[model samples]
Target: MPDRILVPVDGSPLSKRALEVACDEYGTAEITALHVIDPTEPGYSIFGVEYDPSTAPRHGSEAWYERATELADELFEELDALADEHGVSIRTETVVGRPDREIISYATDEDVDQIIVGSHGRGEESRLLLGSVTEAVAFRAPVRVSLIR
Candidate 1:
């Protein structure tokens, strides 16, 4: 009987599936959709590289931050629409940081009872070299983690 279920979404098909799983399994709980704004992401990167967002070109500029917020907003809107279609009320959240760290910290700070995540299978090589967010959260989160592939 999880009280609060946290789902970290990245607009991937896997993420959508994870949301659906949460809705189906935790129908009576508080389901939350969290979108992490990774400034180091290539698409939102101020510079050509995502190695370090703090040193990115104009990284702290108003335009750079605005772009990040814009991307987060778009994801939130899409999540909201999906939740509506599922006939479930979801609480939305946005945070700026590394996706895995942000998600883990939020779950702890907010006392989330469980976390439902998706596995995008970012390719076998990448998964071996660098684990995906779902893997990281599932391993590190203090709360229970349910992964939907």
Candidate 2:
């Protein structure tokens, strides 16, 4: 009996799968697609690839933040359109911070009844070793959580 379902998307295949599952499962309920841009992500220091500090967007710059915002907005718009096609009402939100913490906090603060998420995001190895945002939300969320891989 979920009234509100939260789905976190990161422009990944698994996230899209989760979105599909959420829409099917909660056909008449409100669906919210949230994208989190982690400001602490050090895209600069890659062990294997050549690190380019100049290529990395500075978190404090207005241009950097704006670009990130636009990207997230585009992703949400796609999700929103798909949800609309399915006759489901969907809302979009973008937040800045660590993914795990932000997701958990949002679920707790909002009246979200369920969370549908992918078990792993872009960080494959890191997710295997340190767990993922899905795991963090599953353990700490005040509501039910459905993890899609």
Candidate 3:
């Protein structure tokens, strides 16, 4: 069994499913939740037409950074609540970088034994069978990758 499982949560239902699976299958192991911020994300603002309303700050602005931090905190809070419900403890981390690279890098740097991630995120790639980020992580991660739909 993996001593630690790293899960990347992006507030998407699929990612949430991944988290749920990690908690269910590895309740005794350490679990870490990671959230990454992509500065170049198109239409990142809450008012943008490309994405759902996030009440997010203007993309690339100072307020955007602040909002990102705030959102990260809230994300962790939600994860903590989920963990509590499952009788598990989850450590959360937030970073500013490409999601795939950050997820793989964290697993490598922290020596995590496995990664449980969603097949897709909150992006347009859902139409694809596998999200680009998830595909990259599965191919590049030094540790084992378990993808949940």
Candidate 4:
């Protein structure tokens, strides 16, 4: 088993499953959960919040970042509880950037031995145009990568 494992979380069911696998299978390893906020997709709302241009904060503004941070906090709370259930303690980080790049950079800079990431089953056409984060990380990461779909 890897001594250090990185897990990228996005509050998706597959991401949650990836975390579960990491905690269950690599419980002894040092685990880190990374959440990336893509500034390019400023209109993206993951918490089921309706995106109303009139009411929503301006994209890339301070208020938008604050809202993203708040959402990240909510995600971490749930992840922490899940890790607790598995008797595993994980460090959490939230960064603003593209998910794939951030994940790969973290693994390389932090010297993570392995990465467990979720695959968002995107359709072939969609993937051809914009590859999934899992695909990017798996291809560019220096360490081993395990995918959970």
**TM-score of every candidate:** 0.81, 0.81, 0.85, 0.90
Question: Local error of candidate 2 at 144, Å?
Answer: 0.8
Which 10 residues in a row give candidate 2 its minimum summed lDDT? Answer: 42-51
Over the stretch 7-73, how does candidate 4's per-residue lDDT look in tens digits?
9988888889999999999999999999988899855535354667688799888998898888888
Name the candidate, 1 or 2, with the larger lDDT value: 1
lDDT of 1 by residue, 45-72 (tens): 1212233456544655677777767766
Candidate 4 TM-score versus the reference: 0.90
**RMSD per model, one decimal:** 4.5, 4.6, 4.0, 2.5
Residue-wise lDDT of candidate 2 within 19-135, one digit each (tens)? 888888788888888888877764311112232458746655666677677777777787878777777777888888888888888887888899998776446555463236677
- Put down candidate 3 lDDT per residue, 1-149, tens digits, no spaces: 89999999887777778888999999999999988887778433121124434665566888877777777787779889988899999999888888888898999999999999888544565556677889999999998999886
Give residue 118's error in model 3 in angstroms.
Answer: 0.6
Could you tally the backbone clashes for each prediction? 0, 0, 0, 0
Candidates 1 and 3: which is better by TM-score? 3
User: Model 3 scores what on Cα lDDT?
Assistant: 0.82
Superior candidate under lDDT, 2 versus 4:
4
Give lDDT: candidate 2, residue 3.
89
Q: How displaced is residue 88 in candidate 3, in Å?
A: 0.3
Predicted candidate 4: what Cα RMSD to the true structure? 2.5
Candidate 3 residue pairs in clash (backbone atoms < 3 Å) = none
User: Candidates ranked by lDDT, best first?
Assistant: 4, 3, 1, 2
